[model samples]
Target chain A: MNVRRNLAGVLALCAVAMIFLPLLLTFYLSVFDETLIVFPPHGYTLRWYARIWPEFGAALRTSFFAALAAVAVSLLIGVPAGIGLARYRFRGRDAVATMLLAPLTVPGIAIGLGIFVLAVLIEEHTEWAISGSLALMVAAHVLITTPWVVRLCLASLANHDAAAEEAAASLGARPLAVLWRVTLPAMRSGIVAGGLFAFIVSFENLEMTLFLTAPGMTTLPIAVLQYLQYHIDPLVAAIAVAQVVFVGGALMLLDRHVKLAQVVA
Target chain B: MVEEEHPARLKSVSKRTAATGFLGPATLVVTVMLAAPLLLLLRFSLNRFDIKELMIETVTAENYLRFFTDPFYLGVLRTTVLVAVTSTVLCLLFGLPLAYRLARSQSRWKSLCMLAIVLPLFVGSTVRMVGWMILFAHGGMLDSAVRWVNGVGLEVMYTPFAVVAGIVSINLPYVVLTIQSAIETIDIRIEEAAQSLGAPPGRQFWLVVWPLALPGTAIAGILCFILAMNAYATPYLLGGPRFQMMAPLLYWEFSTNNNWPFASALALILMSTTLVLTACSNLLIPRRYRA
Candidate 1:
């Protein structure tokens, strides 16, 4: 017992230090007066934080709106699709499930590049360039995140009683009422958890955002990347700290209600 | 999805259908927005297309042939595999023990440990990679730490070491989380039974705990493999442009050179290799479980 306990305590401490110390160090780096990231700062200032306000503001706006739209679109499609998959004994269920989850397995490069060149071809055909447009970005995010909502909502639905749905239908409740009253209420936790997961996923997303972002349309991650390419500055550090606050808060909240392992896996 | 159901259970199936209206809007959205574009990319890969000429529409296998034949491209593939495998293996080595540790702890501490384990994931990979860049840089935190202990410095930043370190740090959360769940899945009673069979602590673990944990480890390894192989930004930033992966090469070919053909070809190659590796994993792993 003693050996096991100590091993666990030490490892937990290490994991904590692994994540937090660096975050704290980055936070410290942000406030330093010196532009360079070297330790033992000469003075402290909030100038870098101010710099992010104007420079990265538009990128933040784009990211927020993109993620918002993505969440909206995924919920619209995913919640229903989730119900059908989880509740119905349909043929080709396995194949459909695999198709839904396929994007997760494929390397993102294939998806992004494939989508990129495809968008261009559409532009030629339809005379509209959707590539790197906000709508395009939202569409990409939805493709990626919908499975999250579906998988989670399915899990929620699977746990509930089907008899209730049937009973409600027999009572002359419109199918919409049954879903709004019986189904959604039952899956609310999962829906919220799934939605939150989707939101966070959308929030911190970058890989897809990379190929998708044009010059005028950039997300926070892309902006940081572009800035870091030219110069390594504390403004990034300032932004990193701000983002961590939100992430840290969410992690604590999720860890409270549901096991992250269950939610994530 | 809107089937006729009871009013109390929330039926308005028909009206609900009418409410949402467009049944396959998202599907249409993905097909037009996602699928159509990718198909065009496949076409572009075959055609001789460039920034200046746009498309000559001449079909050619030259792009595919060149990528396969070129040593530069071949070397990038090799490095990508090496980085992916080494980093994934290392994460498993560290994560198995760490996850096992997390699983056996008290409930109060378990939640904290879980949060701590996953905290690294929440930070954007871009920011996380930057931290790693600084940490591994000469006279950086890692450098200073090594120097303080050994009276000499370690050169890691910008090397494969730094790249893999960044990879492991970024991916450590997933591995540990997987291993933790794997450990959780194995009922503790099985290990107890092994103890009653007069097994030593080592046997109790290797024979009982190890076997039970394999599936989770398999999953953990696969995830680490995917992240390592598909990883773009970390290597782009930390690995530098000098060290390349399959993903970034596809990126460079498409974005920098404006060679969508080569990029598409690279994308296909990447997909093929990934599918092959994944198929191999699926075959080998579950078979091992049965055996």
Candidate 2:
């Protein structure tokens, strides 16, 4: 028992260490006011903030809007699907779940390529042109994050007693009214959690976005990739610090409101 | 009760519409449009790209031939599989024990530990990889620490090994949370009974707990395997020039080469490879339990 306890303790420590070391290192590096990102910086200054203000600011805004649009679209599709799957016994429900999850196993590049082909084909087949459009990018991001929302909301729906909805109905609530008053309120945390997941996933996604993004639609992740190809400096480190804070803050908040592990569970 | 039942019931059309109406839109949108398009896109592997046409106009099997025939592409394939497989294996090795700890702990600590494990799941992979990049690059903490230890210069940046480290670190927390909860459900008495029957902890886990936990682990493994297989940004950013992964190759071909047809073909091949790997896992995982 002692040996086993020690083993678990050590592994847990390693887990904490791995997460801690890089985070500390990144924070430490971000303050360095040097071009080389050298260790034990001669001193500290905030010269890097200037780069972010003028250069990366636009990319940051673009990524934000793109992520926002994606999350909204995902919610539009995922919430209804969540309710449908949760409420009804249907033919081939298992297949529906699997189909939603199919995007996960597909390589991001293939998704990129497939979306690219889709845009071209849509243009060729119809008079409407979606090529190099933000709508297409939003659609692609929706494809990625909707499954997470659906699965999460489905879990939430599963946990609720059916009697509550029935009770509302028995009390003279309309179907829509019951959904709004009882069901929607119940799924609120799950929806927020899933939406946040969708937001971050879309915001930081680089691979498929790398293909789908056009001149005006460059996201922060894509910008980082492009900048890194030519230059590696504390500019990215500064950006990393902000990103970690934002994504980390959102994650920690979601954890407080509802345990993230519950979602995973 | 008869009065209650009769008056409260919705019209049959209303019931049918409720069932089919809300569901059909998403099903058609996801399945018929996106899923079916992917099936059509799979043809890219069989045909060569025509630079002149910007579309795949010919079917020659050259692209697929090149992937199977060329040592360069094949090596990348092997490395991708190796990175993904090794990473998943590491996740299992490290994750299962941590999961066991999570399961055995109190509820508060379980949730706390779980929160710690899963909070990173929402953080974008790019952000984590960026953290790795900042730390791993020269003049970063790692180099300075290494220099202090060995009093020598070491160039660890841009190595495939570094890329693997970044990928593994990002994926570990996710896989652990997945298996941990699955471990949470198992009856404690099962383990205790094996102990009473003269089985040591090792034997107990091997003989009993493992078989029960196998399903969750298998699913987690599949998730990790697919993510690692399809990973693009981490490999691209951390590996720099030397690191070649499938996703980046597909990205470059489609985006830069402008040979959309050929690029589509490569994507198809990548898709097929993922399918084969998954199929293999399903067969082998069941067989492992039988053994």
Candidate 3:
């Protein structure tokens, strides 16, 4: 029994190490003075972190605003759709849900290529140009992120009892008032979690953005990838460390309120 | 979720309208942006690629026929399938134990483990692949560490092994989470009952827990397989230019060669293969365990 328990402990530790050690290495490498990302650096320095902003500032701005817009749009579309799906049973309800979630099953590269084709066709025939517009990028991000919001909101709403809202309605509250005071409040945690999921997924996305981004306006991932293609440097590691820290912090904040395991499930 | 509907009230009209109103905006976005584009891809795939005009208005099956008849494309398909399957199997092998541990434990460590597993996802794949490059590069961390212990160096970067490793690492969290959910659904008493019958812990897991978790495992397997098949950055960065996966190949054809017809045909083939595999997994899993 002791031996088995020991084995389990070792296995757990190994799993944790495998997941985290690469990240720790990245963090260590970010501080190296060397330009080529070599190990056992001659000396440690903070130069890479200082240089990242000047190098990747625009990409950071683009990724931030695009992700923010995607989150807002996702919530606008997802919350209402989630509430409807949760509250009402209509004919072909399953089909509607499946269609909304279809993006998850499709490969990202295919979606990228398909959307590119659509943009090209529209550009060829129409006077209105939208091939690399921010609007198109946000729309594509919404396509990828909205499903997550819907799923999370649905999970949240399913756990919420509808009796409270009905009580509010019966107490002379208008339908809008009931939704504002009762329904939306109940779905608050779900919406927040869903919004966070949307933001992170959009920010990290590359496959969808690759085909949609213009030459000058690219997201952070694409910028980093392009940089890596030409040069292997600690500056990229600095950028990576920044991304990991931000995401890790947000996730930690999220875990304080909701069990992420339950959220994912 | 069904509230008691008051049949005599005028509120029913609003409720009836609300469903369509709520669904319309999202449906419009998805249809216009996603479904319509995929349909366009299908049309392009059926058309012929004209060298001078980019794409001619001719319908032909030559693209797909060429894909099947050419040994190069056939080999790429085979390599793609092999890498995906290998990485998925490796992910399952490594992830299942951790997933089971996480599911059964009530310790605070569970949350920490969850954070560790998921935090990597938010960090861009570009970053993680870069990290892998540093770790596996010649005279880099992995090489230096191995040399320190055994007086020998290791070389894995720019190889299929490195590509497979990267795929397994990225997909591990998803596989573990899915399987963890499956195992969590199993009643603890079922395993305890086996324990009471003189079965060892390992035996209990094999005989009782494994059978119950099989459905979730299968679903997780399907997800891992799909993710591995579609992976682009990892194969491109880690596998180097010599490596050819369908996604990167499709990207090359469209971006570099400007072969729209061929790229569309490849995209369709990848999409259809994933769809069929997913359908098969759902169809084959027993109804009770179907995800």
Q: Model 3 residue B220 lDDT?
A: 83
2 or 3: which has the higher TM-score? Answer: 3
Candidate 3 lDDT over A1-265, as tens digits, reads 6687677667656556656666777888899889886677899999899988899999999999999999999999998988989888888889989888788788888898999889888999998789999988998999989988887788789878999988998899998998899989888877886887798779988877889999889999889888889898888888878887877887888788877766654
Q: What fraction of the native interface does candidate 2 get right in terms of contacts? A: 0.50
Clash pairs of candidate 2? Answer: A39-B139, B44-B265, B45-B265
Candidate 1 per-residue lDDT over residues A152-223, each given as its tens digit: 787678768999988999999987899899988888767775776577567667766777888888988778
Candidate 2 regions with alpha-carbon error over 4 angstroms: A125-127, A170-172, A250-265, B1-14, B103-123, B138-140, B184-212, B286-291
Reference-based lDDT, residue B257, model 1: 85
RMSD of each: 5.0, 3.7, 3.4
Worst-scoring 10-residue span by lDDT in model 1 chain A: A11-20
Tell me the whole-model lDDT of each prediction, alpha carbons only. Answer: 0.74, 0.75, 0.84
Q: Per-residue CA lDDT of candidate 3, range B94-185, in tens? A: 78888898899898777777777778877777887777888998878989899999999898888899998888877787788778877887
Top-TM-score candidate index? 3
Candidate 2, residue B31: lDDT: 72
Chain A vs. true chain A, TM-score per model, equals 0.89, 0.91, 0.92
Who is ahead in DockQ, 2 or 3? 3
Better of 1 and 3 by TM-score: 3
**CA shift at A13, candidate 3, in angstroms?**
4.3
Q: Spell out the clash pairs found in candidate 3.
A: none
Relative to the unseen true structure, what is the Cα RMSD of model 1? 5.0
